[model samples]
Target: MIRTILLLAASAVAAIFSGCRSAESTASIPAVRPFDAERYLGTWYEIARLPHSFERDMTKVTAVYTARKDGGIDVLNAGWRNGEYRTARGRARFRGDSTVGELEVSFFGPFYGQYRIIALAPDYSSAIVTSSTCDYLWILARESTLPLETFRQYKEQAAKLGFNVAALEYPNGRPE
Candidate 1:
């Protein structure tokens, strides 16, 4: 009887520990803030990003946005792969408050998903971007290269957002 009781107790303890870990992980995620859509509408070069499946092995990434005739923004994304240029086009619309930097970007047919600007510079020259669910993330720059100090600051911000900043892949053209 004692052995059975001890086993049950151990199981309970393990379960409790697992629950605590899960809660802690979830709580570590940073809160999303409102972003200004208009001020964010422009071309941005990808400076760094967490390793993602779609963008793996891609370099020289750039995203461009222009006002659309139907009150949406036309999105054009391009990158260099294997010495060739690859591109994709999409559309984005402000989610709720246009002043807040949040929008839904769609590339495959009509399906859309959240694109939130989590951090940005005062001149809008650089920004740290993420999706609503925190699955996608990217660091954007107005120029092709990012200064070391600025990159470090952005990495720190991304770490606070529950991202593994160590996983970021910086572009190869610039020296670290």
Candidate 2:
């Protein structure tokens, strides 16, 4: 009888712990406040990001944002692969269904992914963006580089949002 009781107790403990992990996953992801999309438009260098198949073996990545007449936005992503420069043009539209900091971006035809500006510097010098699933992430800067402290803060914020910070890939270390 005692053996059966202990087994039941152990199972209960495991189930409780599993629920706690799900609570962490369900925690809402936060976005930056007072985001100015106009001021945010321009060339931004990609400092780091979570590794993805599309960006494999890429370096010196950069993005340029431009406004469209329809109130949507244009995205030009460029990088160097094997000493050759490659680029991808896409479209982004603010998630009118939700907050201003949330946008939907698409590289392929008509399909979109959630993009939230989880962090941004007051002067618009730096920004960190990520997907709602915490699968895709990027650290960008108006200049070629940002302070080491800022980098750490971005990682910390991403961690709080339930992301895997260890997967971050620095394309060009401390870009010059």
Candidate 3:
């Protein structure tokens, strides 16, 4: 009984903190409209990202997205950590209008995180993605490598959105 109570207490505390964090992070961030989900679906190579605990020491990261019959998206994120390949599966759904680029993705049951596509190339060849918070950011491309100019342009966009662009880690080698 004591253990169960303790667990409940911990969960309550965590929920409170997460609510606060999400409120602050999601504020003022706008998701691109007239977004084409079909164009965005596919494999994306991670060129750079801000360091985070979940992806710590990870390299060669990649994310795969596919449409689910339920009008949601299946997310497959893979990477190499300490020379070992690891993967995480998640699900995502648009927070509001399907045409918007804002989504809520959940790897853990019932706990969703914000996924906002802040920038994308005209041809959908590259993109800049981030969470509700400034703590998470990613530069992704359809190919394993992105052109230097394209990479720089994405970084600048993230910086303008309040992310720490200087802290991005290029696990696949920095774009030349």
Candidate 4:
């Protein structure tokens, strides 16, 4: 009876702690319905994102997408690094049809990572992209600047999907 009691107590404790970490999760993350890939194709300015090593100190970043002849997407990521313009070219392919909003993108050759369109404006003015893992998140806008109200709305959307918006890094290194 004592062993059973201890096991039950341990399980309860584990569940409590896990719940404290986050309420957002992959199972709860949502993607836009019927995402229009054609309108989504073009230049997007990075307003904020979760920082990663590959893009360290990158400012004035932009992601330009163009459809390739092979029915895949060609990605061009450009930024100002150490006062010099730097760019990385990659490719993206949809997991299903363009409307599904599921895709994979890669900066390095062959290897790819998940890229899901979680939230998008009807006019294609702004978008929020994240991985299925919900660990990687990006807030992109058609212009370098975003309206205050719109930014807040996007933040709420990302938070609802389980992203830690408080940790988002503005590429210019200043809190807005």
Candidate 4 structure quality by residue, lDDT tens digits, 1-176: 00111222343355467864222335456567788777889999888887666667788888888998887888888888788987777788887777877777766645565677888888999988876455567888999888878889889888876788888878744335
- Residue 97's lDDT within candidate 1 is 66
Per-residue lDDT of candidate 1, residues 59-138 (tens digit): 87888889887878988888877898878777788777667676777775555655667778887888887654334567
| Deviation in Å, model 2, residue 174 alpha carbon | 6.2
Question: Which stretches of candidate 3 lie above 4 Å from their native place?
Answer: 1-15, 22-26
Residue 156 displacement in candidate 3 (angstroms)? 1.6
Candidate topping lDDT:
3
- Tens-digit per-residue lDDT, 53-96, candidate 2: 67778888888889998888888888888899888777788876
In TM-score terms, which candidate is top? 3
Ranking by TM-score: 3, 4, 2, 1
TM-score of 4: 0.81
- List the global CA lDDT of all models: 0.66, 0.71, 0.76, 0.72
TM-score, predicted candidate 3 vs. hidden true structure? 0.86
Of the candidates numbered 2 and 3, which has the greater TM-score value? 3
Pairs clashing in candidate 1? 35-100, 35-101, 36-101
Query: Model 4, residue 16: what's the lDDT?
Result: 64
Q: Which ranges of candidate 4 are over 4 A from the true structure?
A: 1-27, 172-176
RMSD of each: 12.5, 12.5, 6.4, 11.3
In model 1, which runs have C-alpha deviations exceeding 4 angstroms?
Answer: 1-36, 173-175
| Tens-place lDDT digits, model 3, residues 1-176 | 00111222343357577865422364587878789998999999889987756677788788888999999998888888888988877888899999998887776667676678888888989888776557667888999899998888788777777777888888788785
